[model samples]
Target chain A: MAEARRRILVVEDEYIIAVDLADALAESGIEVVGPVGNVARALAVIEAEPLDGAILDINLAGDAVYPVADALRARFIPFVFATGYDRSAIASGYETVPRCEKPVDGKRVADLLFRSIADR
Target chain B: MADDSPAAAPSPGSDELLRVVIESATDFAIFSMDPSGLVTGWNTGAERLLGYSETEMLGRSADAIFTPEDRVAGKAEEERRVATAEGRAIDERWQMRKNGDRFWASGLMMPLSAPGLGYVKILRDRTEQHHTEMRIRESEARFRLLATNIPQLVFRAQADGRRSWGSPQWIDFTGLSFEDSMGFGWLDAIHPEDRDATLAAWNDAAEIGEYYVEHRVRRATTGEYRWHQTRARPIQTGTDDRDVDWVGTMTDVHDLRELQGRQQILMAELQHRTRNLLAVTQAIAARTLRASASLDAFSTEFAGRLRALSRVQGLLARTDQGAIGLRELVWGEMEMHGDIEGRVTITGPTVTLTPTTAQTIGLALHELATNALKHGALAHDEGRLGIGWDVAATRPGYALVLDWCESGVALPHGRPRHAGYGSELIERALPYQLGAMTRLDFTADGVRCRITIPLRSANHG
Candidate 1:
């Protein structure tokens, strides 16, 4: 059986970081979705697209991305958190989601995204 | 007409009676002066006070006893003119005596006119009373100086709350002049928020004739409000059944009040830090104890871990309570093994780790790096380790990925039958505290451990 190409969404505010992550994922042969930087655009992409999984930045322009986390949860799309802050700074409800700290390795990005999609 | 009057009776007995009366008086100086202002009669009072006997003064001109300046200014002529025109003249002035010394005197000159003779004048002296009045005036001047120089805003007010006298100190302290500090002007200097209560307190005290004390005033320099204690009380008896004057003072106590506020905040911060430290220590102890087989083993392991913690804490203290750079902390832990010159390569952009995160990660990294040095890859000089991390994009969170990769060490025969303290702590304890997913891989060539800590638990330094 041929390996299925996983669809992943990247939500990051910083322009360079978002581009780096998308390029890294695409190089790993995974299909990259919208690398949206704001909450409204991220939510619209999630609703319009067929996303298998996602990577989310904890802060977007000084506001939290919990609403995106909530929408992903409702859609049963597994997502991982990427942050510079420690775990204590995250809200209590989202504690169980997988998290990766920067600077992320290209291979680990492939592995974690593949695992999150396969688990879903 | 002269023979009909008692003065012209020419009785030797009447003359003796008059002499007896004049000589016996102590408080009054009775003397007679002729129309030319000469001393024609003198009594015992004049003899004792003026230091002149009645016989010596009887023929002398009264002008001889006046001060040189008063004589030059025609004071004697002025007195005589008033006496002749107004029948009697009263003057309070400096007078000279037989010794040419001056005394403040209240003198009265009365003109005595008979039917056929020239006018006779009666003079009375008042030097003693004048001295008492001078002393009283001096005392009042001293009191005024004291009130003006006090550090507080000293003031005097009438019974109706009208300010009568405000000290110069008020101008010095409030930068307001005497006129500006009176009545409602004083209330204007008070902070608007505190003005009503301060006025009410003053009014109540004034109505009941009690001491008024209030703490509400504005600072002179900044126009910022400050606490002041203003106190006032009636200067005289309140029960005198008359209008009373009140004397008061105001003192600045803002510094004392501010010190008390700072002390309270410091006390609260101390309490919070104590509780947080206790919680962190308890967590460390519980995790260490649970991972040990025996108390002896636990003690040794815990001691080593605490020593590592203390080393990191010392480094942080040197930085003056600021975040320690991640690269520095990692390099510091590795250098403790004595020789890591070519074996370990740490790379990353400068990331500042919070103190709590630094200690946790410092200990975790210390244990892993120690294990690798002792048995895994870094034990061999040919081995190389790459330690690096960067931020990743994840929804509503950040991912920090740290890698420990080793090369050129001989492979372990198989994964160890039992996981050791270092393995369990890196895989379990760190994830629990840091909310990161940790992975440990044992390969034929070297060991690799990766930790992805969430930003929430790991961002602050």
Candidate 2:
């Protein structure tokens, strides 16, 4: 039996940021599941698809992605939050989640996500 | 030897000396009244002090010299009766002058040992002294009132920096009684961390007759140490060593200090946000260049993206509350392309976006609309586009699902083989940024897209 490609869901709202992140993930030889624009699609994909891990934008089209974060947490799926804001903007319970500030390097984010999942 | 006879009285030369001495007296109004209280004699002193000469007053009733109220109350008659019974009477009361002005008179009535003459009256003016005393009392009362009622913590200290007085406000603010704050005891109300510095400043100020310092004082009500600016100036005495006292006030400045601190933090945050925006702009330019085949194409696309960003910024600025409505964001992009009234049909309840979300979504909408105008259904006059969104009934929380459809135009053969930034934005960026599951399909008829993403929370618009 052959192992499946590791599919990572990408949750971001900005077009440019999402494209850059997807390109970085593709360059890393990782199968990208989504470049979702909001929390609804992110959670839907998370439930319908078998995710290896996830890359999340802390805010989604004017909405906070905490619901998606909480869902990923419930599933024991490791993820990294990509944000334009600082760490203080993150709620208390999600402190341990890794944060990557804006103008994010996709390769760095991918590495962090993989490492976090591996650690898990 | 008994000297009871008139022939035994005084010699003619001695009588002349007596008249000259009495007339020369300017302070006392030497005048004599008969048994009936009639003016019998008046001297130059009487004329100067009462504004009346002997010619005008000698035959007048002496009762005219008393104030009307005193005369009405029988004070003049009472004085005569007292003088006749006791052989003398003295009083300090208001006496009328010839000009109708009143003077405080120190007067005496005495009986003379002469036949048919009852008494002689002596009057002196004391008006200036009485007015001076009253003025001093009024000034003292005003000072007492201001010291007690003012809001600032007022204080008075001796030349040597020994505090002599503190306003009631000090007691109210620091819960220290006047007795406790007097002298050096008031130092205890100051913050312990500020005590040494305050004392040093106080000593310095004592020499210069100016006291000014800012330090913390413990507030009694909250037991919190709050900042206060204290200032005092020397009560200037004419002589250098006679600088007798310092009056000072302490004003609360803790709120202003805290506001200044907050302003610094906000400034830093603004700097950070500006840096992030610049980086994002750089990335947009780089990606647009890579995705374009020619400089003109790159310029046009880049300019369009920048405009998209600026439009969102304008909207955010106008709203001022930091949240932008999703309907407004979508309409803004479509409207910029030209008249969107008939061609674009949008349906959604209401959705307000955060600053980050609105900007990102606004750019995505711009890219979508631009592509439609260039190669999609919107390129044709009869073509139509419909956009709508709704919250998905998802477990744990609601999610957003949006649909875009176009009609009245022939579609392409199939989905484009190479994914450009716009396609990538729709297919990959949506999922990455918003965790959205999106589908972009090009059919023989038109292009359609469906996006489903999780809402932030159930209550959010």
Candidate 3:
């Protein structure tokens, strides 16, 4: 069977950071998903798309992205956190997941997402 | 019975004139007493002076005028003896008046030639003069009392610079005896550093008769230095430009001077810290803008990060060398995320961090947490996270290891179409600033990131 191309979702509040991350992942040969900036759009995209892994920013226009995290968890999908705050600032339940500090490195995101999907 | 044969009788006019002279005298009680001291005659002067009328006192004994104590001491007899042998006598003594009150009296008595006339006496009241003398004595006593009890060192010296007197208070304050404080011995208590200058000032003041001022003395009890303002003036002067004495006092003013010095040092330190903070803020702004693609995105993200930096700066301002509790740094960053309690997890031993390390770690942690909430595990309610760190001793130096992990979040469809600022900051900028190695793992179930920083880098930064 041919290896399936890994898919990722990027939900970030900063447009330039989100764009940079998407490009880095694509250059690494993995497919890119929506770089949604708001919680509502991010949720809609998550519900509609098929993804293997994801990268998330903890804040979206003064709102938390925990609801999106909750929906992704219910669907049994995995994601990585990318935030500008310390990991201690993240919710308790998501403590064991990996986190990438921003401004995000595109290559690191691609590498993390691919490894996460391959391991699963 | 009229005598017609032998001698010429005195004129009636001469006797009348003698009665008128005695009646007009008001200051003295002029009367005649017999050999045994019985009163034989009283004039209007005697009536007014003794508060007794001539009719009331004519038959009374003159000895009754002496006070009880004077009479007991034979003062009346003493006056009689002096008058009889010395021809006349004058004395000052206490005497009782008709009202039973006492008056100080100046009395004179003379022997008379008439057989029945033993002595003639005159008395003057001296109570007003006695009171005036008493007031002058009391004023001198009060001045002495004040000179003895004052806390400051006090001295009185002759115009020629010889110490005439020093208050007992001076001996107590200067740890010297009255004799020691009289002259040059008083200068021995002055601090060695200030002794020369103090002596010069004192000599100048004495020579020129000018007011002396100096802040150069040592405390007797503690042997500590203090500032003292000594002032003196010529109190009296006589003929030929001779000054009688000079009086002076010394007071302490050391603590006020020390407080002013400390205040100036603190002001300078504050100025230096403010300038350092401004430089750091400028660097952060320039970096954020350079990496941003557009003005809107740069402003939003830069402002947010700058606010985080400012919070760290506020904490640093309160510390002596820009150090703070590690826990405080963590909490401050979490609070910036707006209700991050339910969305964040932190685990570590409590520790203090230096200013530069705190800032570097703070910015790195901020970027990571922001990303996690926006796109990773914290994006959904059911998603979970874990964060922890540990310190270990290594060959080069101590090492700090931190991990962030997430689970229970679904992946997105297809792939992310655009690169963003968050990714570049976390993977590139963080390692560059911290001089550390970092790893990021994205999985089907969650994401994990680990960073290892050398102890030296952690401390210096």
Candidate 4:
């Protein structure tokens, strides 16, 4: 039997960017979970989904994405930050987390996510 | 040599030596006054100091040398009484000379019990020393006046930033008493986070000769913390560094610092927004290109979408707080297509939106109006478009419910372009971007779309 497609979740607020990111992830033959726009929905996905990594935007609407990040960390689910903020603005313990800074393409996001999560 | 003890009676040779010493002392006028205050003996020093020879001043009242004010105040008699009772009396006053000039005189009077020696007086001119003391008194009074009245909180500290004194303003602002503010007690009034840095600045001040730090200080009345610029400088007690005392002020700079901080935040926000806008614009272009049939179609669609995005960016930029009204967004979007003076009706309460909500929603309104102009109501002169919005109460808070109605036009006879970019934005992007609930209906007469944006979404900064 063919193995299940690798699943990845996207948490971004902007509409066009989210669609573009979702399309890019889908094109890579990866089963994309969501481009959930806020922290609450992102956390729901983290709790329900299994078996892969995630891409997170540092700012979800007006809320920090750290709670989602903390959830991901507690589950040992690997993730990378796609953010507009610099390292200093990120919460501590997340400064060292790999980041694909804002205005980056989906391929860069996907590649960084896979590289960080390949072992798991 | 054998009679060298000071308490012993003077030898004959020593008494002669004392007479010579007394007569030659030009600064001290040694003289004897009789019981009636008459001058009975005088020396050369007396003639030099008082500008009088023995012949001129002999038998004259010693009161003649006292200033008129001092004599009128009975200072001469008071000196005599004090000397008789106390064995020695010291008096300092402005005395008159034979030429009518004046000098400050510090005098000592002693009563001698030996015969013919009623009182012995020694006088020394101390005019320069008296002038110096007077100058110091006047300067000290001026310093007190300035320090107390100035708006800044004045303080005096040692070289190591130990508080020696604080002005009344300190007590009034920090609620710290004079005693409580002594030593490290004043540090309690400083914000704990700022104290370490403030102390560091003071520690450096000893070598740098100045102390300067900005910190939060607690206000006694409101118990609020306000930013204060604390500064001090060594008072320069001497050449030695350890003898230094510092005088400084703590000036309230909360408002000024807050303004500067807000300006910096605005600058950073502008930079972040510019970058985010560029990202959104890129996505719009990419999506438009994928939906277009050819390069020409892509150019037309992409340009329209960019214009919509740029217009909202303009609206957002002009506003200090990015507050875009619902009516203004709809009216401006409709007006961009053509003359919307009477053809469009927009009604709404004062509904404000954040920049992100306005940007995507502005584009959605642009697309709806564009479609109406191309195929719906505005395509015919008989067409009418009505747009209205109101903030309706929702479960948690309130949500803005906007209605767009296009009437007096026959519906498209063929299938609806459900897969197009405009439909995708209205049906999908609105919900994802603003967390809005939207319904687009293909009614027989025209198209009616209702967009409900929950105010609880990411619309706030």
Question: Taking the tens digit of each residue's C-alpha lDDT, what string does model 1 give over B1-461?
Answer: 76699987766788798788878875566677777777888778877667778888887877766789999999987887787788788888887778987776677876777522223433456566665556656755776888877777787876545677778777766777788877767666777787667667767886677656556676688787778877788764232447467877788888888897787655644443343334344445555686788999789777777767777777777886557778888888888777787777888766777665677788878787777877877788888888998777577677777888877878776676777666766775565445568998877778888888777545633
The superposed Cα distance between candidate 4 and the true structure at residue B184, in angstroms, equals 4.9
True contacts kept of each: 0.00, 0.37, 0.00, 0.57
Docking class for model 3 is: incorrect
Q: How do the predictions measure up, each by TM-score?
A: 0.56, 0.57, 0.46, 0.76
Descending-lDDT candidate ranking? 4, 2, 1, 3
**True-vs-predicted CA distance for residue A8, candidate 3, Å:** 51
Q: What local lDDT does model 4 show for residue B102?
A: 97
Runs off by more than 4 Å, candidate 2:
A1-120, B1-145, B158-162, B193-197, B200-213, B237-244, B258-271, B458-461
lDDT, candidates in the order shown: 0.73, 0.81, 0.72, 0.84
TM-score of the A-chain for all models: 0.93, 0.93, 0.91, 0.92
Listed per prediction, chain B TM-scores read 0.65, 0.64, 0.54, 0.74
Give the per-residue lDDT digits (tens) of candidate 2, residues A7-115: 9999876666665678778878888987777788888998899888888877564578999999999999899987766676577898889988777788888889878
- The sequence of per-residue lDDT tens digits that candidate 4 reaches over residues A37-100 is 9999998888887848888887777788899989998989899988777665667889879998
What tens digits encode model 1's per-residue C-alpha lDDT throughout A23-89? 6788788788877777888899999999888898776655689999999999999999876545655
lDDT per residue for candidate 2 within B330-369, as digits (tens), equals 8888888887778889999887776776776677777778
DockQ of 2: 0.19
Model number with the top lDDT: 4
DockQ of each: 0.02, 0.19, 0.01, 0.57
Residue B401, candidate 4: C-alpha displacement in angstroms: 5.4
* Best model number under TM-score: 4
